[model samples]
Target: MQVRHERPMSELSYQVSAPLKLTLEAGQIVTIKHWSLDRIDYPEAVDILPKSGLLSIPFQGVDIQFFVEFETDTQDTYLKFKNLTGRQRETLAIFYRSILSGKMVSTGDMITSLDTPVDLVPMGETDDEKASDTARASPQFLRVIWNVAFYLILSVVVFGLIGQQIWTRISQVSLMHARVVAPLVEHRNTDAAYVDEILVAIGDEVQRGQTLIRLNLPEHDAKLTDIRGRISAAETRLQALENTRQVHLNTGDPTRRVLLQAYNQTVASLNDRNFFSGRDLDDVINAWHDLRDFDDLARLAKGPFYDILRGLDVEIQAQNDALGRLKRELGNHKDAMDAVDIVATTAGTILQIDVFEDQYIARGMLAITIEENRPRMVRAWLSEEMSQTVHIGMQSRIRFSEAGQTRSVMGTISDIQASIDPDISDDFGIIVSVAFNDMNVTQTRHTFRTNAPVTLSASKDWADFGSLIGLER
Candidate 1:
């Protein structure tokens, strides 16, 4: 809050010795070697770099000038020598000339000064070329030195401008990175049925786990018919024998009556409930029938004579189960011709269907896709350097290229590492999640279910810069 200004510092000597012609730019801090306040020959002044302010104070045995930049009403100045060991109040008073000049003198009369005095070599050199004219014409080596000095001065000015621009560019920084995806599900039981016929062509809408196609077994019907016929024949013969044998038994024929009656009763027992003597008669027909005769009649009689079947329904269930397993296995083949039943796995609008019903498909085929529900989650990783700067409950903005719309979202920094990549990785990035904020897409199209990539930007901490802006009261 205090105001002060720089006064030029010079290394005083009666002789003018501008050796080396080393140049230092404005605002750059450089060391003055071979010069100290302790030297009598060097006097009390320092060789200040151009544009720097210096204060002279009596030190040890000499008046020592230390470099500093003084502040005016509201501007900043980098005081070169932060701390000084000279007499404090005396040195402060001597450098207070500019402050007094501004307060006491009129603007037109006051001397314009800050860095100009440093160009004067205290060893008897001045900026006025006219005053030094007599000195300039004296010697051949002196003329040469003068010309060299002028070239050296021009060179310093040229390089300084270039160096400043280079520094500014180097100070600029930006951030961007490649995205990492979180796979929705690791594995799936893709092997499934297709009962409802898939109506649309490829790229048709299909929900997750929705039934798509139905598989049919053309041979299932013929086998059903043959098993039924045998059951009916067995029952009819047993019935006729039962009526005749009972009458003979009454006429005193004991052996024939026993055999005939036993047969009729056994037939009755077999027709009880499609479970004939603990055996599946359908299976029996299947296993023992003639392949060429085509057992349609027997299979057709199944329901009517179901009561007389064998294997007690277990064998029948086994056959059905075996057929089911086969249908499931065929789904893996892209060239499957069998009918099937496919169902949707998740709740979503079907996006597309790649294949049609009655069409053969192969294993691991792309059937269709679904665009999932809302409140999409986007993830990003921050560098280890920013781990501390970023924290939970920070706000972020996102813009999707396809949608061409902006979205404002709040983020909760769930995790942060003490160091980058604690182990496996050489570079570490902390994971963060950005939750959507009241942002809705009227347009229905989206790239993927919940995971959509978009450009992102983060708000940085600007408290220090804010001080310069007068935001902090």
Candidate 2:
């Protein structure tokens, strides 16, 4: 073998002194400069060479064969042997070994022509004897190993799941007949009335004092009308009394009349300025009385006109008081009419709205129901035997549905009470209530309103392995 001036690829690969002629099954002839047991290097245009085909190297009295594949590298183009038969591989190894041992070799001569006898090392044996000596197992043995590995992994998984179910049966208590609940509020019609308007719909969020429905009470209409009529009559009577008093004053003595006119002017001036103080009016009245008395004393006389003026004053005062009372009664009637607007007493979402416009509802009739906007809870009934496993402040998981999806929220047993009704106690069980955790309460407050069904599972602190083994714990 000739030492190549280029980089050495492997110890077995040799640079040939002369180019070796090779032919492809596709009828293309080529020359190779370097060859090894596994591959060959040749200078050829990659485009002209077949990608893969049978390759033949002419030797003395025989043709050495290989299946070659064309490949390109960054530095050069070459062909690698593909699907080499055992005999072809061994023949190539002998040729390479013979040349390495200082024997003259030529591709044109038979391999036996060499003076040295070359022993063919088995294909794929390495220099390390320990590794080469290891015998490869048959396909049947490999299949058995893979089957054993698969069964071992499957057995572990199956046993692990069975153990988990067994543990849960011992340590957990599941309550299935549970429901989500919150504080509820009811809206009842307080008086006999026809529903005039419904201001809210079911599922509407409302605030305290928000008007929910408007009722028009037919009974209030007659009372309001009567009060209004009385007020109108009282106002008319008051105006008529003022006319009669003016006429009565006109018939009084001129002196008294002049004094009355002057007093009236002063009162009008005070009232026009919104200065209705009693002290100002009293001062004017006192001055007038003093002037009238002085005048009467100076004249040394008293007249029927004074008596008439006093009587008119008394009558007008009585009329004014009556008018004032009538006006107050009118206001009270109006307030009763306004009370027909039913308002929310607590903030919440409206749940049931049974009344519609123009529908007559009686006094104390059920009209609407509201679910208060408070933290939701889950309620369940536990039997006496199962109740022993549950306690207040115990952790639980509450499962419910929202928008067609199942959800789980963590909660704690907040209350446990004996069934109040003897029928319920004998028929069902004890009452247990669960309060949701803060994180879940805020998110699902509206999602689970009153009476929404749920499933509650409370896990105990201790595991009862004896129970799983059919022994009492």
Candidate 3:
């Protein structure tokens, strides 16, 4: 390493390994000078004697001392130098060679200094050892780099595989527990009657207009039968009256025939004449009187028979009116009896059967409950916070767990309740309804006892980081 200095002349020291053969007189002084190639502002000078000497060099306003020692008593002269301040060791080596080569003059003129230059070798480890050490460390450095790259590739592959398994596109949404239910159609009776037969039972599928139960109303049936009998009897009596009247008309009496002829002639004359004046009106009155006289004479000739016939006709009319009313009552009674066979008004599965065979069911009593099995719906209650994110028509996933198995189905939010249910707990959740995409309750209708517990999840575009790691918010 090269050391840089900011001073004009810096102190440098080196140990001399070779001996100098000099005929030195005692107390002779030699001057050593230092020149800085980079700085020309100041040159430094130091005076030294052979024995032990101390020299000061000015370096950036600070005086640095150099200690030099020479041992002449030894077989080889040893020179020791100390307190080097600058890193220009090569310059110091050259200066040391000038001394050995006689470039440095002795204070006495008798010793002439040579003007030749020489090179000084520095002391340290050889170049071969440095090359060997560098060669040894190169493989280790390359191995470290290779290991880092290998681990980086391995981490990429490992995390990529793990991400493929766990980092799915599925959104992490709050799951709301829901229930599966079909539309319910309640069957009820309008009149009190005994359950004659139950055509269907719970869990049985029924179609529209299919009979679900049969009720027996004996009293209503008896009333209907009695009304029919009374109607029949009334009709027979009316026929007899008609027959008697026809016989009376066919039988000829001389007084009755003469009176009837005179009445007919009088009525014909009255109809033919126009009573436009007082004389015409008098003639009409006369004709009317004559007709009334004949009618009275005819009635008198027929005597008690005619009176009986007239009374029979009045009685028959009254009986006919009564018969008509009775017939209407019978028809109404028959309709009431027919109502005993309770039929389903819609197609669905029978969720409940309230009445059993021979059971007495009262008016407006529940018979059966049928639930429409198509287009299955799931009702979910979401928390108030979660409900804010949910909306109608959003896609949802429904999970049904039963018998140690879980099945998932896709659906859409069909409806949302306008208000929160008062009966629900303080969780403060609103009800949401979902409709299955293509599935119906018919396939798994039996699985729903009342309301099958389900899990509802709506799809979201993004999720939080904590949720992905299974952390609760």
Measured by lDDT, the strongest candidate is 2
Q: Which stretches of candidate 3 lie over 4 Å from their true place?
A: 1-172, 200-211, 218-222, 250-308, 339-341, 402-405, 418-428, 440-450, 461-473
Q: Score every model by TM-score.
A: 0.30, 0.52, 0.47
Q: Model 2 over residues 112-227: C-alpha lDDT tens digits?
A: 43333444567864668766577676699889999999999999999999998977667778875688776678889888899998989987999999989988877687887887
TM-score, cand. 2: 0.52
Tens-place lDDT per residue, model 3, 65-118, is 444334332213223333333333333344345544545423232112212233
Candidate 1 similarity to native, TM-score: 0.30
The lDDT of each candidate is 0.42, 0.72, 0.64
10 residues in a row with least lDDT, candidate 1: 13-22
Q: Ten consecutive residues with minimal summed lDDT in candidate 3? A: 37-46
Measured on C-alpha atoms, candidate 2 has an lDDT of: 0.72
Best prediction by TM-score: 2
lDDT of 1 by residue, 156-243 (tens): 9989989977653343111234132322321121444332365434334455555544543334334434434544554555555555
Error of 2 at 60 (Å): 99
